[model samples]
Target: MLKLIVNNLKERKIGLHELNSEELTEALHYAVANQDFALQREIGNHFTHIYDQTDEIPYWFKSEYDDDVTIINFGQRDKVVDWSSVTLEDCLPLTHSKHKPLLNGFKNWLLAVSDPLENGGAVIKTSTVKMRVEKVLSLIDAILLRSAALQLSLYHLSHITCDFWLSLFKAMSENGPINGVYDFTGRTVELVKAHVKSITQEQVNAFASKYPFVIRDIAEDDLTLHLAKQERVKACCWLYSQGYYKYGSSFIATGNGAVLAILLFEGKIASPSLNTPTSTELWLTEKERSTEYRPFNTENSKTSTAEATINTYISMAKLINTNIFKDNASSPSIEATKALSVRKINDLVILKPAGRTQTLHPDVVFKLTRQSFEFVLKFQQDILDA
Candidate 1:
């Protein structure tokens, strides 16, 4: 049983690019070792919605954002949780009506358990134990499989009393074999014992050190660590689903009087980057990044909370205050505006707050042409030129 517990954690080691601390790693272990439903929820939520900390978000994200974000397909990997292995049907109890916990027993357990997040112990009432167990298992599996990370943490995994966890798994195993529904109980233990090449603390620390998302907060660093990897960004996607900036890619084309910053997300913006060079690098200042935030609505259900998401994003943007955006266009606009001289056409800077929760790039690319450079230099933020 102990081996199974270790293997469950080992299989879902943290990602190399993650910016978590040893405390988080240990906390994750604690969740698995104990039957802490809140911790399990945290693990599941993180896996389903991590963003690429550094990926750029295009300008004018305040516009309507629509994205499906990352789809957690269980079949895609062989992690301990194996989301693909279990189906919704499989999760449903054989006879939910029959197995509902007896009221007195449930109330008794509820009082005994305490959540680390201060959400009060998760209630396993007679009405929801079956579903709750399934949910808990899902959370456990996700963390155990997805922890395949290399992010830094601040604590160490310690030995904890897991008699409750053992019983829970044993019970889940009996309910039609937790093969696909919560198999980590057995597999995770094996992986940890064997010293598999899962995520390492050094890797996680390196990631956080590079991004340093905030002055001294987990949210910002979490964002930064997720982004520095350059690709396969997890943090960015996490934000999109939260409805931060609307997501998409784009093609930049410069004309004589203005620059064309075409949005990849199929939508319309009444006022985009104006023709003025001030619009050239559409960068977001500290104030702007802090102000622009949205809510998460993956299921579009009222149950989804966006406050935690907003705080996380605001914290992250501060870390990448000056993260540079690449110039998409090779040529400059040649048109000249009345107010300013047409000496140069610099790159455009686009600011992305925790813009949205979807698969999106932090910035977009714009091609520069000589004609467009002249246009931007001569033009102003006025409508006549834009």
Candidate 2:
């Protein structure tokens, strides 16, 4: 486990040699400025250890480091300096940069959770288990660091919930393919798609081997209202079994033929709401009652329904992004939503959202939301403005 962590640190260019006395001094000042006594102690120990060493120091450290005894001894010596009164500006070059602070915070959190000494050495016993936990922590730390560097808010990071991580592990362990779509809520479909693409099969397998769990496969069905309704119910039930029941959304990544379904929970509920059927549902129902399978099975109706469903999802995606970001006082330019269009080529329904295109097979049923219909009414006005 120790070796694995060391290797990962090496890969990230965060080796022990990278932690110079100067950087450790800066960390100490930052901790002292924040009045974080615990962090101050940790940084102080590192700073004192590095400064006391007679051996060669890291390249980033200054050659005349012996001259600045006052800065180095700020937190190390017995001299009483008021931590609470110290402002950030007083720290000067000792302060961490924008993303570094968040990265440091995440690293601290990871260490706290995984450190056996802090947990009374009760959480982890075996080296194998420890290595697995560390791997997950490293993956999360990397994601958080990237998000911080990109200037994404804590709210955006919050969306990568514990459930999402658990589901990822489940997907890895389960040999059968998981059929689901990405949640398009909060205009995060593009971000989620990028993340999905970045994930390697090897990582999934490794996570799965570490923690094995079963995830039931969702079978593919023809694109129809009846099928969509049935699949939605099945999906909700599966999620409920996994202790997730609240909000649900799906998005498809046409490039990789990947579908991700995300389920979120808030408060407990006796039952989830089942709203009225859509026009496609009505058409399916009418066809079922007429005993005329040929009319309902016609290529024209299949193409039309498929196109309608894709359009509905695209509109909903736009509205969701608009409302979420607007509330947060940020406007996200969603080029994918703006470029969304659907066309029928012969019996097939082709959806082009941004540059990526997806063909809706007759065997797949696309899910739709109430917001999709509501937004479609003003589609023309919205498109012209965009």
Evaluated with lDDT, which candidate comes out highest? 2
Tens digit per residue, CA lDDT, model 1, 278-358: 111111112123435643223321122233332222222111111112121111111111111111110111112334664
TM-score of each: 0.16, 0.19
Query: How many residue pairs clash (N, CA or C atoms closer than 3 angstroms) in each of the candidate models, in the order given?
Result: 102, 10
lDDT of 2 by residue, 159-264 (tens): 4433343333222222111111212222122323333444455654543343232122223443332223333333323323333322235321111111112222
- The 0-to-1 C-alpha lDDT of every candidate, in the order given, reads 0.27, 0.32
> Which numbered prediction scores highest in TM-score against the true structure?
2
- Lowest lDDT block of 10, candidate 1: 150-159
